[model samples]
Target: MTALGELQRLRASRGGPPRKRENKAAFLFLLPWFAGLLLITAGPIAVSLVLGFTDYNLIQPPEFNGLDNFNRMLSDERLHSALRVTFTYVLVSVPLQLACALGLALLLDRGLRGLSFYRSAFYLPSLLGSSVAIAVLWQQIFGAEGMVNQVLGLIGVQGRGWISDPSTALSTLIVLNVWTFGAPMVIFLAGLRQIPVMYYEAAAVDGANRWTQFRKITVPLLSPIIFFNLVLQVIHAFQSFTQAFVVSGGSGGPSDSTLFYTLYLYQRGFNNFDMGYASALAWLLLVIIAGFTAVNFWAAKRWVFYDD
Candidate 1:
């Protein structure tokens, strides 16, 4: 029989089209989200790509600048600083956040008492840490005569302005980012629960120590989750804006020490009214993030384990 005839016969033998009742219901439920995705998400991206090639500020008509904005990045000193700060934050914060997340996940996996409460308490920071109010609170806590300094006074160790010093401002933000490890920790906990109890029991029968079992079994089994979180957290860290913006009072000050890439893009687009340059910067960020994510996927082949 011909391929199409055979496929039709096979389908005829099993069933016709699926019932539309449940499918129609699901589509109805999803309509709002789909509409939002098209209007809120996809629409802006199309406009921004066109903006990247223009010289429009809010006051003037958009004049095509071709590759001018992209080319200017080659010699832009502030762009370089923004890139360096962003890279440092991503490199330092992501690994530290993952490590803290993994550690907390492992702890919670031991089936401790009040597990829900502990998990909720740990995850609370991730829920609220990125809010403007939280960032403002962080600024106050890290100020020279703030809570940190007051605690230091108790120990007779004088404290410096953690968020005001050029050298230390970014570090404080890194800590803030790291403190929100609860999200990944929750994901890791879920991954841990999925592991078969029989695997650990089998390892125990072979006289494996806790360390050995964790190293050989838990680590291998959790590699896929680790890879997932790594990619997500890296992109998240690189795009961080609100914390740095609030901490530095939207100036990225203390010598531009907290100049995250997104903050710099905002400074160019809105503050300086250089919308074209800001749009270019936004696309540049997408390219950088895409490159890193591609590398991560390529690297995953070596370590990420799947059961097929």
Candidate 2:
């Protein structure tokens, strides 16, 4: 047979001009991601949506109901308490975190010796903030018998159990959030470096002092980055979980002082097996985050500057 005739024979045997083979390779490359998105992400999301309208224990088959879970949330006193606690946490932590970050970034912008080491050292806490070991360390540090009270004892200050005291427990978490300001600090450092040094030199020629230069040049230029960091830190603070969970022993104890929304949602869904109510709670959290982000974006129009 001629070469062309052989090719035709191969295609005939394969039942086409190899369209299936080309499709097979395409599907093979996409298989793992497809499976992961569907099974790992989309499946759970769809299940949660369905569960929001049902009564599910996760141990028993789900019993379908309409809007009951959401309606129950309206009068749930614990949900209100949790919302208040979470709002307090977000409002306190986000601004403090950003302020600390901006201050550190300003200090680092001075171009000092051993700069890289200092940068890495400062960022280390942020890298470790979400780790269980750090959470445990925080627990010990704020515990009644821990180092905080030890120093207080030496000075005759008589420090209370910071993590166990209802009034102080949430404050400890807020401090922890602020301590992890390193990530935003690094971002602000990058943003500061991107500002043209010529701007400062020109301001100097115009007889502007350091304070005047910063106000006229750096602050306006850095405002957008500040806004970006603010929005992200706000969202993260609102959804804070690990620190509160570990510190509060997952009970939101010391009179529910540390009962964050996510912690309460976990307790209702997984711990109590009330999946329907938990799903509704999760949706409510989504709405809260979305609303806050929208407000920030709307507010940014007035203040956040884009030099371009």
Question: How much does candidate 2 score in TM-score?
Answer: 0.86
Q: How big is the positional error of residue 163 in model 2, measured in Å on the Cα after superposition? A: 1.6
Which residue pairs of candidate 2 clash? none
What tens digits encode model 1's per-residue C-alpha lDDT throughout 1-308? 22323543575697669765687888899999888887898777778899999998988899998999988999999899999999999999999999999999998896789899989999999999889999999999999988999999999999999999999999999999999999999989988998999999999999999999999999999988898889889989998999999999999988989999999999998889998889889889989999998899789879988664
TM-score, predicted candidate 1 vs. hidden true structure: 0.88
C-alpha-based local distance difference test score of model 2: 0.87
Over 4 Å off, model 1: 1-38
**Poorest lDDT segment (10 consecutive residues) of candidate 1:** 1-10
* lDDT agreement with native, every candidate: 0.90, 0.87
lDDT of 2 by residue, 22-116 (tens): 77888899999999999998787777788899999978898999999988988998888899999999998889989899988898886788878
TM-score of each: 0.88, 0.86
lDDT of 2 at 44: 77
